[model samples]
Target: MAYYTSNAEHPIDIVNIASLENRVKARMDRGAFGYIREGAEDEWTLRENTRAFNDLRIAPRVLQGIDHVDLSTSIFGIDLKTPIIEAPSAAHGLAHVKGEVDTAIGAAKAGTLFAMSTYGSTPVEEAAAAAPEAPQFFQLYMSKDDGFNEFLIKKAVKAGVKAIIMTVDSTLGGYREEDIVSHFQFPLPMPNLAAYSASDGVGKGISEIYAAAKQDFVPSDIAKVKDMSGLPVFVKGIQSPEDAIVAIQAGADGIWVSNHGGRQLDGGPASISVLPAIAKAVNHQVPVIFDSGVRRGQHVFKALASGADLVAIGRPVIYGLNLGGAEGVKSVFDHLNMELSITMQLAGTKTIEEIKKTTLL
Candidate 1:
């Protein structure tokens, strides 16, 4: 069963993601809000993630004579109605009553993908059932115990996940000052980690939970995950061209460029800053998934131009979920798609392929 008891009442006239975040901040408990809102020490990377995007300028062409725009694209053989998909974040119950179940439903409704975290408050099978038709993926935090790892792999496969997203970052928790000052602890159960007593991972700090995770996450684990699930494996949390190439050589079917939303490392380069080089390194050997500070349609446009095949969103979806549950989550995706379409039209790029061909200044 999923954690939590009731849903949040929908907010009125929430105009944008920023406004929605402010609304959540006003009403949510301090600790819960900070956990989602704050980043690692000094938070330079976190702040840079968006600032870097803001630095890039787009040059729109006017004479293409296009009438309609198409946002359709595919990854690992699964088609997406829009390039924006949900990046997995843990403990949705903290943001909403329905938790990951609501998130999955919202993403499904928007005709995009939702990747459920291993630390999700909802069980894998339950969330899967909530959105049976959605093309779902499982984001894994490999445990030190092989038995546990095998169990989760089998369970995710049984739930009909299309791919396995192995989060290569966060073998350990970052020095998040907010969490420490606030003494924040997960207030709800993480149903996915219920199998291990010590690792049940509720009511404890993130670092404590990470202590039970496998710290030796090497490139070979990419193939190991594929063998375990017999599905395509995406190595998420990649930020460098060198690591991107290594992941491909280790048989990764996809490269997910991220900085864990700057939650893991404080001084690292913004995920966007490193994407073009990493994409060049991969040279389209496999699909590239980019996420880390996407907030607008223009950000999506810039990422595609910079080399991302698809852009994944994190905090904005949670902001939506915090405000309106499944509907709120759907609203986030719909809004981004609307924005991306508008950007594409204004840029004279009618298709996603054309967006990829664009060059950012």
Candidate 2:
């Protein structure tokens, strides 16, 4: 079988999205699970990301005679069945055997876009092939060498990605405490980015890789990427209004409000906390995408109501993938879409546009 189902020997109990996290924890080795579960120092931002959503109350507009609801939305001219995208996480090889490839397939089958990570174990071409029918986006890291950076941008364009998400945060990794405790390191090589070194394009030396990673990714790099590819460029990891405006001025086609899933700055504010101000700053000039601590459909609702054009799921996607691989990832989408629909109906929202700041109290 391409994917597996629950059985007596490998019993699974994923009645809800929250339970799926537990199920995956039971199934995977401790180190691998913590890598997906843990965040930065003290994890203050991580807890606050979700807590910010819970702090808000949805003011339902009852007695509306709405017959149906529409969840389909578009970003960067790409139509999505839902306003959800999978966030780009590194090294999915730890989650399942097929790694990021299976996650791409599941996202495609769910009527959404799958972001190909710059750190994925599978090559971008192979992942694109896995989901030929799905709209794909490429997340990139700007290398110190202008030549190498251009090489990666050109590669993603040649692979046929719809948009380029240039992650503005994590010019370096964060102080993830659990990772240190477990002594965890990525098991698989980053095949998608392996071609950016040497003449033969077979090896990316350790020193060369660190040099690229340590290089500062400034707003000028965003402009360079736009000039290099002429593709729609989205600046991810914009956590404040100032950063959002800087991205827009730098020619960002979209602004992704994120705190690197609370893995970068441990003391930084929640992505949701900064979302409203950033959205107001953009003021509909471009799409605003939100991610960091989205775990439920209600969180998605709060995001759109607060001014996010779309939401990207991170850990939950991995939770599902660990439990059932491709099939598990697909199930996660089903649960989210259904829950979102139900939430909308009860809130008297019949259209995605109807979800506005006024929808929340």
Candidate 3:
């Protein structure tokens, strides 16, 4: 029997997506594991992100005679093999030795997209170079300094990122009890920050680093980012209909529906719960991208049914990266694609278009 295992001596067998955490926990250190696992204060929204998916039931239409399922979809004129894409999560070096370089390689191998965070352990060019053919996006945390923001955006554009995903939810670090208790600080260099600051965050903590981010974000910032990068800009962290409309009106190419993976606000509604209204508000004027608490293929299906052109995974990719590096990240995407193919066939949907039309009970 062929099985996937990070360590041959330990022989940790590959299992379902939900099982990756506990398996990773057994091997990773306390602070590093906590950073990936724990969310905001009380973790109510964190837990609810997954729990709320149970509210929507998949009303599969049986016996439609669908044999082959097509998972291909296009975003911003770029084609992808699966609707599932990698979400931007900072500091992949905390999880794997290779960091986002491995992530970019894996996503490219899987024929999907990987959004690289501004705080990524690897520099934009190195990550983009890791998988030259891959469709990658840069997630920007606009710095308080205008020069730094313009410099970083131009650097990413030079590296060939297809779009800019401006994360609006996190102007500051969240009150993550786990990090506070564990006294967690990034152990490795954040070259992205170092490129401009001339410091690899030798002794500073994440909160201290976040202090340099721009606190006030106006709607015009959307157009500003686009003009800065000369690439399509997607306003991430949108949770309301009003915000969605504001973004589109401000020339946003897409509206990314996320609650910062439940890492920003503990009591806020789950990303899935708020997705419908935001999607309706955007009203297909721009693409709606979604993330947060997505573990199963059904969650991906439900999100598309609710009105998402694409769904991104954050923690799961890290889990895979921790366990198996580039191959592991590819495995994570491969498994989800397989599960989604099964869901499509069982639900009588043959294409991504059909899955979007699926009704959840």
Candidate 4:
């Protein structure tokens, strides 16, 4: 049997999106993937990420008519059918052969946004083409070299990306203990742009090129990218109010509060715990996004009430891909939308705007 198919009698039954997590866990050994980070020493932040959401309770409203719901919302002027975006992670090829391409198709099918990572298995152009009509954001990793960074930004602009997400947390790799202990290999190899440049008689090393690209990067680099590509720009991995302030000042169109899934820093507060403060700091200048450990519809509601303009999911989609490829990804989003609809109906929210902080206790 194939790893993913629509057949009903497969060894792994994937009726629900959440079920795929267990199935993937059962089938794959822990050591197969990298980026899990290291030790319980830093896991405090990881635990807090989910626990912070749990600390809050929702105050459901009854007797309010909500037979219909509108989940649509706009991010950076592009309307998304839902308030969810696919959080970028490295190397989808490990989960399935179609890799990021399949993931993009799935996100489009679900009527959501897709964010492609710097280290995605497929090239950015290919992924973008796979989901032409879907809103797409290119996640950028600051290279040690500025020139290389410029190359990527320019290329992404030409590729029709709707936004550039500067990931600020991963200046260096995280201490994911699971990835370390398992010796998990990344599914894709690093881009060989430098090698190609060298072949063309450019003497710059990859790091040097990357540094040059970022050499002139200032607060306005956000504006420059937006002007160059006519796309919105966002800064991700923001943890502090001060940093959030800097991002907004730097011409960032949005702020994404993330601890890099607790993969970057182990002792940081859960992204959700700090989201309200971050949102407050932005003071409604721009939308604040939340991610880290969102696993349920209640978590989504809590994030929305806490002030997240949108929420992103990482591990859950990967789990789905591992279990059933494109169908698995579609199933996960369907389940989430269904759950969100039910939660909204129960909470008496007929539109996303109607879901307010008061909905949660």
RMSD of each: 2.1, 3.8, 3.9, 4.9
* Model 2 error, position 99 (Å): 1.2
Q: How close is every model to the real structure, measured as TM-score?
A: 0.96, 0.91, 0.96, 0.86
lDDT per residue for candidate 2 within 1-361, as digits (tens), equals 1222222112124556766677777867676688788889999999899888987788777889987889998876788899878998876777877888788988988889999887776888888889988999899876666786788778888888988999878777777888778776554567756676523222333234445673566677778889998898999889889988988897899998999888889999888888888999999999888998887888889899999989999888887777767777777887888788888888989877887645577
lDDT of 4 by residue, 99-151 (tens): 78888888898899888887666778888899899888898876655566677
| Cα-based lDDT for every prediction | 0.88, 0.80, 0.89, 0.72
lDDT of 1: 0.88
Worst 10 residues of 3 by lDDT: 1-10
Error of 2 at 211 (Å): 5.2
Residue ranges of candidate 4 with Cα displaced over 4 Å: 1-19, 34-42, 191-230, 357-359
Q: lDDT by residue for model 1 over 1-361, one digit each (tens)?
A: 2334337544334455566677778878788889998889999999899889988888888989998899999887788899999999998888888899999999998899999999898999989999999899999999988788888989999999999999989889889999999898888877778855545665778777888889998778888889899999999999989999899999999999999998999999999999999999999999999999888899999999999999999999888888888888888888888888989999989999999999888
239 Cα displacement, candidate 2 (Å):
0.6
Ranked by lDDT, top first:
3, 1, 2, 4
Residue 8: error of model 2 in Å?
14
> Against the hidden true structure, what lDDT does model 2 obtain?
0.80
